[model samples]
Target: MDLHARLKTYLQNNPEAVGKVVDYNAGTDRLFPLDLTAANTELTTAIIADTQAFSNWVSDKLRANNCRYGIGGYMEHRTIYAVSSHFDTEDEPRRLHLGIDIWSDAGTPVYAPLAGKVHSFQDNNNQGDYGPAIILQHDLNGLALYSLYGHLSRQSLDGLSVGMSVHKNQQIATLGNNQENGQWPPHLHFQLMFDMEGNYGDYPGVCKYSEKEKYRKNIPDPGLLLGF
Candidate 1:
Protein backbone atom coordinates (compact mmCIF):
# COMPACT_ATOMS: atom_id res chain seq x y z
CA MET A 1 0.00 0.00 0.00
CA ASP A 2 1.05 3.60 -0.50
CA LEU A 3 2.00 5.87 2.40
CA HIS A 4 -1.31 7.76 2.42
CA ALA A 5 -3.40 4.60 2.39
CA ARG A 6 -1.14 2.95 4.92
CA LEU A 7 -1.42 5.88 7.33
CA LYS A 8 -5.20 5.90 7.17
CA THR A 9 -5.37 2.17 7.73
CA TYR A 10 -3.00 2.30 10.67
CA LEU A 11 -4.91 5.06 12.44
CA GLN A 12 -8.22 3.38 11.75
CA ASN A 13 -6.95 0.14 13.24
CA ASN A 14 -5.48 1.71 16.37
CA PRO A 15 -7.63 4.60 17.45
CA GLU A 16 -6.65 4.37 21.09
CA ALA A 17 -2.96 4.64 20.27
CA VAL A 18 -3.45 8.23 19.12
CA GLY A 19 -3.73 11.02 21.68
CA LYS A 20 -5.00 14.54 21.79
CA VAL A 21 -2.85 17.40 20.50
CA VAL A 22 -4.66 19.97 22.69
CA ASP A 23 -7.02 19.83 25.63
CA TYR A 24 -10.63 19.61 24.58
CA ASN A 25 -13.78 18.16 26.12
CA ALA A 26 -16.52 17.25 23.67
CA GLY A 27 -19.02 17.20 26.55
CA THR A 28 -18.30 20.81 27.50
CA ASP A 29 -15.87 22.92 25.47
CA ARG A 30 -16.94 23.86 21.96
CA LEU A 31 -14.95 24.31 18.77
CA PHE A 32 -15.51 27.06 16.22
CA PRO A 33 -14.71 26.13 12.63
CA LEU A 34 -12.79 29.18 11.45
CA ASP A 35 -12.72 30.44 7.88
CA LEU A 36 -9.83 32.60 6.69
CA THR A 37 -10.74 32.43 3.04
CA ALA A 38 -12.18 35.26 0.99
CA ALA A 39 -15.57 33.67 1.59
CA ASN A 40 -15.31 34.96 5.15
CA THR A 41 -16.60 38.45 4.38
CA GLU A 42 -16.02 39.49 7.98
CA LEU A 43 -12.24 39.27 7.66
CA THR A 44 -11.14 42.49 6.02
CA THR A 45 -7.70 43.50 4.78
CA ALA A 46 -7.46 45.89 7.73
CA ILE A 47 -7.93 43.10 10.27
CA ILE A 48 -5.48 40.90 8.38
CA ALA A 49 -2.82 43.63 8.40
CA ASP A 50 -3.05 44.26 12.16
CA THR A 51 -1.97 41.24 14.17
CA GLN A 52 -3.71 42.45 17.30
CA ALA A 53 -6.90 43.21 15.44
CA PHE A 54 -6.80 39.90 13.66
CA SER A 55 -6.39 38.09 16.99
CA ASN A 56 -9.25 40.05 18.49
CA TRP A 57 -11.45 39.10 15.58
CA VAL A 58 -10.71 35.43 16.11
CA SER A 59 -11.32 35.65 19.86
CA ASP A 60 -14.52 37.57 19.34
CA LYS A 61 -15.85 34.92 17.01
CA LEU A 62 -15.06 32.19 19.50
CA ARG A 63 -16.66 34.15 22.31
CA ALA A 64 -19.79 34.82 20.32
CA ASN A 65 -20.09 31.12 19.59
CA ASN A 66 -19.28 30.01 23.15
CA CYS A 67 -16.31 28.06 21.87
CA ARG A 68 -12.97 27.61 23.57
CA TYR A 69 -11.02 26.84 20.44
CA GLY A 70 -11.12 27.87 16.78
CA ILE A 71 -10.18 25.10 14.38
CA GLY A 72 -9.84 24.41 10.62
CA GLY A 73 -7.51 25.08 7.63
CA TYR A 74 -6.45 21.77 6.14
CA MET A 75 -5.92 22.38 2.42
CA GLU A 76 -7.68 25.69 2.89
CA HIS A 77 -6.89 28.36 0.32
CA ARG A 78 -6.73 31.42 2.51
CA THR A 79 -6.54 35.02 1.37
CA ILE A 80 -4.95 36.03 4.68
CA TYR A 81 -1.53 35.27 3.18
CA ALA A 82 -1.70 38.73 1.66
CA VAL A 83 -0.69 39.98 5.10
CA SER A 84 2.87 38.73 4.51
CA SER A 85 5.25 38.61 1.59
CA HIS A 86 6.82 35.49 3.16
CA PHE A 87 4.37 33.35 1.21
CA ASP A 88 4.91 35.05 -2.13
CA THR A 89 6.88 33.52 -4.99
CA GLU A 90 7.95 34.62 -8.46
CA ASP A 91 5.15 32.75 -10.20
CA GLU A 92 2.44 32.02 -7.61
CA PRO A 93 1.66 32.87 -4.00
CA ARG A 94 1.54 30.13 -1.37
CA ARG A 95 -1.97 30.47 0.02
CA LEU A 96 -2.71 26.76 0.29
CA HIS A 97 -2.38 25.75 3.93
CA LEU A 98 -1.32 22.13 4.42
CA GLY A 99 -1.90 21.96 8.16
CA ILE A 100 -4.77 22.21 10.59
CA ASP A 101 -4.48 25.26 12.86
CA ILE A 102 -5.81 25.04 16.41
CA TRP A 103 -6.43 28.56 17.70
CA SER A 104 -6.34 28.90 21.46
CA ASP A 105 -4.63 30.75 24.31
CA ALA A 106 -0.90 31.41 24.05
CA GLY A 107 0.02 29.17 26.94
CA THR A 108 -2.03 26.21 25.75
CA PRO A 109 -0.22 22.92 26.16
CA VAL A 110 0.55 20.71 23.13
CA TYR A 111 0.90 16.95 23.30
CA ALA A 112 2.35 14.34 20.99
CA PRO A 113 -0.36 12.31 19.31
CA LEU A 114 1.75 9.17 19.17
CA ALA A 115 5.10 7.76 20.21
CA GLY A 116 7.94 9.35 18.26
CA LYS A 117 11.44 10.73 18.45
CA VAL A 118 12.51 14.26 17.81
CA HIS A 119 13.76 14.21 14.25
CA SER A 120 14.65 17.89 14.20
CA PHE A 121 13.66 21.21 15.77
CA GLN A 122 14.57 24.92 15.68
CA ASP A 123 13.19 28.40 16.09
CA ASN A 124 12.40 29.60 12.57
CA ASN A 125 11.84 33.15 13.75
CA ASN A 126 11.32 34.82 10.41
CA GLN A 127 8.42 37.21 10.18
CA GLY A 128 5.18 35.39 9.33
CA ASP A 129 7.08 32.13 9.81
CA TYR A 130 6.69 29.11 12.03
CA GLY A 131 8.62 30.73 14.92
CA PRO A 132 9.45 27.61 16.95
CA ALA A 133 8.95 24.40 14.97
CA ILE A 134 9.46 20.73 15.74
CA ILE A 135 9.39 17.67 13.52
CA LEU A 136 8.99 14.19 14.99
CA GLN A 137 9.70 10.87 13.28
CA HIS A 138 7.49 7.83 13.79
CA ASP A 139 7.12 4.34 12.39
CA LEU A 140 3.73 2.88 11.55
CA ASN A 141 4.58 -0.80 11.66
CA GLY A 142 7.47 -0.38 9.18
CA LEU A 143 6.29 2.74 7.37
CA ALA A 144 8.05 5.97 8.36
CA LEU A 145 5.95 9.05 9.00
CA TYR A 146 6.47 12.51 10.44
CA SER A 147 4.50 15.08 12.38
CA LEU A 148 5.25 18.81 12.64
CA TYR A 149 4.30 21.27 15.36
CA GLY A 150 4.77 24.95 14.47
CA HIS A 151 4.17 28.32 16.12
CA LEU A 152 5.23 27.02 19.50
CA SER A 153 6.80 28.76 22.48
CA ARG A 154 10.57 29.13 22.25
CA GLN A 155 10.83 27.41 25.61
CA SER A 156 9.57 24.30 23.87
CA LEU A 157 12.99 23.87 22.30
CA ASP A 158 14.87 24.28 25.56
CA GLY A 159 16.87 21.15 26.39
CA LEU A 160 15.42 19.38 23.36
CA SER A 161 17.82 17.43 21.16
CA VAL A 162 17.62 15.56 17.92
CA GLY A 163 16.53 11.89 18.30
CA MET A 164 15.03 12.53 21.73
CA SER A 165 12.33 9.99 22.54
CA VAL A 166 8.82 11.36 23.11
CA HIS A 167 6.05 9.27 24.63
CA LYS A 168 2.54 9.24 23.28
CA ASN A 169 0.41 12.03 24.78
CA GLN A 170 3.55 13.60 26.26
CA GLN A 171 3.54 17.33 26.74
CA ILE A 172 5.97 18.45 24.08
CA ALA A 173 5.37 22.20 24.01
CA THR A 174 3.03 25.14 24.46
CA LEU A 175 1.49 27.67 22.12
CA GLY A 176 3.42 30.90 21.59
CA ASN A 177 2.35 34.52 21.65
CA ASN A 178 2.47 37.01 18.79
CA GLN A 179 5.83 38.37 19.88
CA GLU A 180 7.56 35.01 19.35
CA ASN A 181 5.11 33.08 17.18
CA GLY A 182 5.92 34.73 13.85
CA GLN A 183 3.75 37.72 14.78
CA TRP A 184 0.46 36.04 14.14
CA PRO A 185 -2.41 35.00 16.39
CA PRO A 186 -1.62 32.28 18.93
CA HIS A 187 -2.30 28.93 17.27
CA LEU A 188 -0.76 25.53 16.79
CA HIS A 189 -0.05 24.51 13.19
CA PHE A 190 -0.18 20.71 13.17
CA GLN A 191 0.62 18.63 10.12
CA LEU A 192 1.51 15.05 9.16
CA MET A 193 4.05 14.12 6.52
CA PHE A 194 5.04 10.89 4.84
CA ASP A 195 8.27 12.46 3.62
CA MET A 196 10.15 15.54 4.76
CA GLU A 197 11.76 15.96 1.32
CA GLY A 198 15.16 16.10 3.09
CA ASN A 199 13.96 19.04 5.21
CA TYR A 200 15.11 19.32 8.76
CA GLY A 201 13.96 21.62 11.59
CA ASP A 202 11.39 23.16 9.19
CA TYR A 203 9.12 22.23 6.30
CA PRO A 204 6.69 24.09 4.08
CA GLY A 205 3.32 24.27 5.85
CA VAL A 206 2.00 26.37 2.99
CA CYS A 207 2.65 25.69 -0.70
CA LYS A 208 1.86 27.34 -4.01
CA TYR A 209 -1.69 26.58 -5.14
CA SER A 210 -0.40 25.04 -8.32
CA GLU A 211 1.64 22.45 -6.43
CA LYS A 212 -1.31 21.10 -4.45
CA GLU A 213 -1.15 17.65 -6.05
CA LYS A 214 2.55 17.26 -5.29
CA TYR A 215 2.04 18.09 -1.61
CA ARG A 216 -1.15 16.08 -1.25
CA LYS A 217 0.85 12.90 -1.62
CA ASN A 218 3.43 13.85 1.01
CA ILE A 219 1.18 15.62 3.53
CA PRO A 220 -2.11 14.13 4.58
CA ASP A 221 -5.00 15.54 6.60
CA PRO A 222 -4.02 15.75 10.26
CA GLY A 223 -7.61 15.02 11.26
CA LEU A 224 -6.84 11.38 10.64
CA LEU A 225 -5.16 11.42 14.03
CA LEU A 226 -6.79 14.53 15.50
CA GLY A 227 -10.12 12.65 15.15
CA PHE A 228 -12.11 15.74 14.24
Candidate 2:
Protein backbone atom coordinates (compact mmCIF):
# COMPACT_ATOMS: atom_id res chain seq x y z
CA MET A 1 0.00 0.00 0.00
CA ASP A 2 0.98 3.65 -0.48
CA LEU A 3 1.55 6.24 2.26
CA HIS A 4 -2.01 7.51 2.29
CA ALA A 5 -3.45 4.01 2.36
CA ARG A 6 -1.20 3.07 5.23
CA LEU A 7 -2.17 6.26 7.09
CA LYS A 8 -5.87 5.48 6.71
CA THR A 9 -5.29 1.99 8.06
CA TYR A 10 -3.29 3.32 11.01
CA LEU A 11 -6.02 5.76 12.00
CA GLN A 12 -8.68 3.07 11.67
CA ASN A 13 -6.95 0.35 13.68
CA ASN A 14 -5.65 2.57 16.49
CA PRO A 15 -8.12 5.34 17.09
CA GLU A 16 -7.33 5.72 20.78
CA ALA A 17 -3.57 5.19 20.83
CA VAL A 18 -2.61 8.85 20.84
CA GLY A 19 -3.39 11.34 23.61
CA LYS A 20 -3.06 15.04 24.45
CA VAL A 21 -0.05 16.80 22.94
CA VAL A 22 -0.06 19.93 25.09
CA ASP A 23 -1.51 21.36 28.33
CA TYR A 24 -5.01 21.06 26.95
CA ASN A 25 -5.44 17.39 27.84
CA ALA A 26 -9.16 17.52 27.05
CA GLY A 27 -8.30 18.71 23.53
CA THR A 28 -11.55 20.68 23.59
CA ASP A 29 -10.67 24.03 25.02
CA ARG A 30 -11.38 27.45 23.59
CA LEU A 31 -8.85 26.89 20.86
CA PHE A 32 -8.51 29.62 18.25
CA PRO A 33 -6.90 29.54 14.83
CA LEU A 34 -4.19 32.17 14.39
CA ASP A 35 -3.40 33.86 11.09
CA LEU A 36 0.33 34.42 10.69
CA THR A 37 0.02 34.11 6.96
CA ALA A 38 0.74 36.96 4.57
CA ALA A 39 -2.92 37.99 4.55
CA ASN A 40 -3.05 39.36 8.09
CA THR A 41 -2.32 43.07 7.83
CA GLU A 42 -2.81 43.62 11.53
CA LEU A 43 -0.16 41.01 12.33
CA THR A 44 2.19 42.57 9.80
CA THR A 45 1.99 45.83 11.70
CA ALA A 46 1.60 44.48 15.26
CA ILE A 47 4.61 42.22 15.66
CA ILE A 48 7.09 44.37 13.78
CA ALA A 49 10.51 42.67 14.34
CA ASP A 50 10.85 42.34 18.10
CA THR A 51 10.81 38.71 19.26
CA GLN A 52 9.54 39.68 22.73
CA ALA A 53 6.88 41.82 21.13
CA PHE A 54 5.93 38.89 18.93
CA SER A 55 5.67 36.62 21.95
CA ASN A 56 3.68 39.27 23.77
CA TRP A 57 1.34 39.58 20.83
CA VAL A 58 0.61 35.85 20.87
CA SER A 59 0.05 35.77 24.62
CA ASP A 60 -2.15 38.83 24.49
CA LYS A 61 -4.24 37.38 21.72
CA LEU A 62 -4.77 34.14 23.60
CA ARG A 63 -5.73 36.07 26.72
CA ALA A 64 -8.11 38.35 24.85
CA ASN A 65 -9.86 35.36 23.31
CA ASN A 66 -9.99 33.66 26.73
CA CYS A 67 -8.16 30.77 25.13
CA ARG A 68 -5.35 28.73 26.66
CA TYR A 69 -3.85 28.02 23.27
CA GLY A 70 -3.97 29.17 19.67
CA ILE A 71 -3.69 26.60 16.92
CA GLY A 72 -3.57 26.24 13.09
CA GLY A 73 -0.98 26.89 10.34
CA TYR A 74 -0.97 23.37 9.04
CA MET A 75 -0.01 23.69 5.36
CA GLU A 76 -0.29 27.47 5.84
CA HIS A 77 1.71 30.07 3.96
CA ARG A 78 3.15 32.31 6.64
CA THR A 79 5.16 35.54 6.48
CA ILE A 80 6.61 35.32 10.01
CA TYR A 81 9.22 32.86 8.73
CA ALA A 82 11.07 35.74 7.10
CA VAL A 83 12.99 36.24 10.36
CA SER A 84 15.35 33.36 9.54
CA SER A 85 17.64 32.69 6.63
CA HIS A 86 16.85 28.97 6.98
CA PHE A 87 13.37 29.47 5.52
CA ASP A 88 14.48 32.00 2.86
CA THR A 89 15.67 31.60 -0.70
CA GLU A 90 16.53 33.89 -3.57
CA ASP A 91 13.80 32.13 -5.52
CA GLU A 92 10.59 30.74 -4.02
CA PRO A 93 10.56 30.81 -0.20
CA ARG A 94 9.57 28.02 2.16
CA ARG A 95 6.57 29.56 3.87
CA LEU A 96 4.31 26.55 3.73
CA HIS A 97 3.94 25.16 7.28
CA LEU A 98 3.74 21.37 7.29
CA GLY A 99 3.09 20.99 11.04
CA ILE A 100 0.50 22.07 13.59
CA ASP A 101 1.86 24.43 16.23
CA ILE A 102 0.45 24.63 19.77
CA TRP A 103 1.21 28.12 21.06
CA SER A 104 1.71 28.51 24.80
CA ASP A 105 4.10 30.14 27.28
CA ALA A 106 7.68 29.05 27.73
CA GLY A 107 8.49 26.18 30.14
CA THR A 108 5.11 24.58 29.42
CA PRO A 109 5.57 20.84 29.61
CA VAL A 110 5.07 18.69 26.50
CA TYR A 111 3.78 15.15 26.75
CA ALA A 112 3.98 12.03 24.66
CA PRO A 113 0.72 11.13 22.94
CA LEU A 114 1.62 7.44 22.82
CA ALA A 115 4.20 4.99 24.03
CA GLY A 116 7.24 5.01 21.78
CA LYS A 117 11.03 4.91 21.68
CA VAL A 118 13.18 7.85 20.83
CA HIS A 119 14.12 7.68 17.16
CA SER A 120 16.55 10.56 17.50
CA PHE A 121 17.19 13.84 19.33
CA GLN A 122 19.31 16.89 18.59
CA ASP A 123 19.75 20.58 19.24
CA ASN A 124 19.45 22.16 15.81
CA ASN A 125 20.77 25.50 17.05
CA ASN A 126 20.16 27.78 14.12
CA GLN A 127 17.94 30.70 13.33
CA GLY A 128 14.31 29.57 12.87
CA ASP A 129 15.30 25.95 13.51
CA TYR A 130 13.73 23.44 15.85
CA GLY A 131 16.40 24.15 18.50
CA PRO A 132 15.90 21.02 20.60
CA ALA A 133 13.93 18.30 18.77
CA ILE A 134 12.92 14.73 19.51
CA ILE A 135 11.38 12.18 17.17
CA LEU A 136 9.65 9.10 18.55
CA GLN A 137 8.99 5.93 16.55
CA HIS A 138 5.84 3.91 17.17
CA ASP A 139 4.03 0.90 15.69
CA LEU A 140 0.30 0.44 15.86
CA ASN A 141 -0.59 -3.09 14.75
CA GLY A 142 2.50 -3.25 12.55
CA LEU A 143 2.12 0.19 10.98
CA ALA A 144 5.18 2.34 11.68
CA LEU A 145 4.68 6.02 12.46
CA TYR A 146 6.79 8.78 13.90
CA SER A 147 5.87 11.80 16.05
CA LEU A 148 8.06 14.87 16.15
CA TYR A 149 8.21 17.33 19.07
CA GLY A 150 10.03 20.49 18.13
CA HIS A 151 10.96 23.82 19.77
CA LEU A 152 11.86 22.29 23.10
CA SER A 153 13.92 23.75 25.92
CA ARG A 154 17.66 23.15 25.84
CA GLN A 155 17.56 21.02 28.99
CA SER A 156 15.06 18.70 27.33
CA LEU A 157 17.83 17.18 25.24
CA ASP A 158 20.10 16.53 28.18
CA GLY A 159 20.64 12.84 29.08
CA LEU A 160 18.35 11.79 26.23
CA SER A 161 19.64 8.99 24.02
CA VAL A 162 18.39 7.21 20.94
CA GLY A 163 16.00 4.37 21.85
CA MET A 164 15.01 5.81 25.24
CA SER A 165 11.55 4.59 26.25
CA VAL A 166 8.73 7.10 26.56
CA HIS A 167 5.21 6.18 27.68
CA LYS A 168 1.93 7.82 26.83
CA ASN A 169 1.21 11.12 28.63
CA GLN A 170 4.77 11.13 29.90
CA GLN A 171 6.34 14.54 30.39
CA ILE A 172 9.09 14.45 27.80
CA ALA A 173 10.11 18.08 27.43
CA THR A 174 9.19 21.67 28.18
CA LEU A 175 8.45 24.51 25.74
CA GLY A 176 11.71 26.31 25.08
CA ASN A 177 12.36 29.97 25.73
CA ASN A 178 13.15 32.17 22.74
CA GLN A 179 16.90 31.83 23.00
CA GLU A 180 16.75 28.05 22.98
CA ASN A 181 13.86 27.55 20.55
CA GLY A 182 15.50 29.30 17.59
CA GLN A 183 14.54 32.92 18.32
CA TRP A 184 10.77 32.61 17.91
CA PRO A 185 7.78 32.73 20.17
CA PRO A 186 7.41 29.58 22.27
CA HIS A 187 5.30 26.75 20.79
CA LEU A 188 5.46 23.08 20.01
CA HIS A 189 6.00 22.39 16.32
CA PHE A 190 4.41 18.95 16.22
CA GLN A 191 4.41 16.83 13.08
CA LEU A 192 3.44 13.28 12.15
CA MET A 193 5.37 11.59 9.36
CA PHE A 194 5.03 8.23 7.65
CA ASP A 195 8.61 8.31 6.39
CA MET A 196 11.66 10.09 7.80
CA GLU A 197 13.07 10.82 4.34
CA GLY A 198 16.38 9.74 5.92
CA ASN A 199 16.46 12.90 8.06
CA TYR A 200 17.40 12.76 11.71
CA GLY A 201 16.78 14.94 14.77
CA ASP A 202 14.74 17.21 12.45
CA TYR A 203 12.30 17.13 9.57
CA PRO A 204 10.82 19.82 7.38
CA GLY A 205 7.98 21.12 9.54
CA VAL A 206 7.73 23.87 6.93
CA CYS A 207 8.24 23.29 3.22
CA LYS A 208 8.41 25.18 -0.04
CA TYR A 209 5.02 26.37 -1.25
CA SER A 210 5.41 24.59 -4.57
CA GLU A 211 5.80 21.22 -2.81
CA LYS A 212 2.69 21.57 -0.62
CA GLU A 213 0.82 18.88 -2.56
CA LYS A 214 3.66 16.39 -2.16
CA TYR A 215 4.15 16.98 1.59
CA ARG A 216 0.43 16.80 2.34
CA LYS A 217 0.25 13.18 1.23
CA ASN A 218 2.80 11.84 3.72
CA ILE A 219 1.77 14.33 6.43
CA PRO A 220 -1.79 13.65 7.52
CA ASP A 221 -3.97 16.11 9.39
CA PRO A 222 -2.59 16.07 12.97
CA GLY A 223 -6.12 16.67 14.25
CA LEU A 224 -6.79 13.00 13.55
CA LEU A 225 -4.58 12.31 16.58
CA LEU A 226 -4.96 15.53 18.57
CA GLY A 227 -8.77 15.31 18.12
CA PHE A 228 -9.28 19.08 18.14
Stretches of candidate 1 off by over 4 Å are none
* Candidate 1 positional error at 116, Å: 0.7
Residue 164's lDDT within candidate 2 is 91
- Candidate of highest lDDT: 1
Give each prediction's root-mean-square deviation over alpha carbons: 0.8, 1.8
What TM-score would every model get versus the actual structure? Answer: 0.98, 0.93
Give the lDDT of residue 24 in candidate 1.
Answer: 78
Model 1 C-alpha lDDT per residue in residues 75-151, reported as the tens digit of each score: 99999998899999998999999999999989899999999899999999988999999999998788898999999
lDDT score for residue 89 of model 2: 80
Count of clashing residue pairs in every prediction? 0, 0
Candidate 1 backbone clash number: 0
Q: Name model 2 segments beyond 4 Å from true.
A: 25-28, 45-48
lDDT of 2 at 109: 90
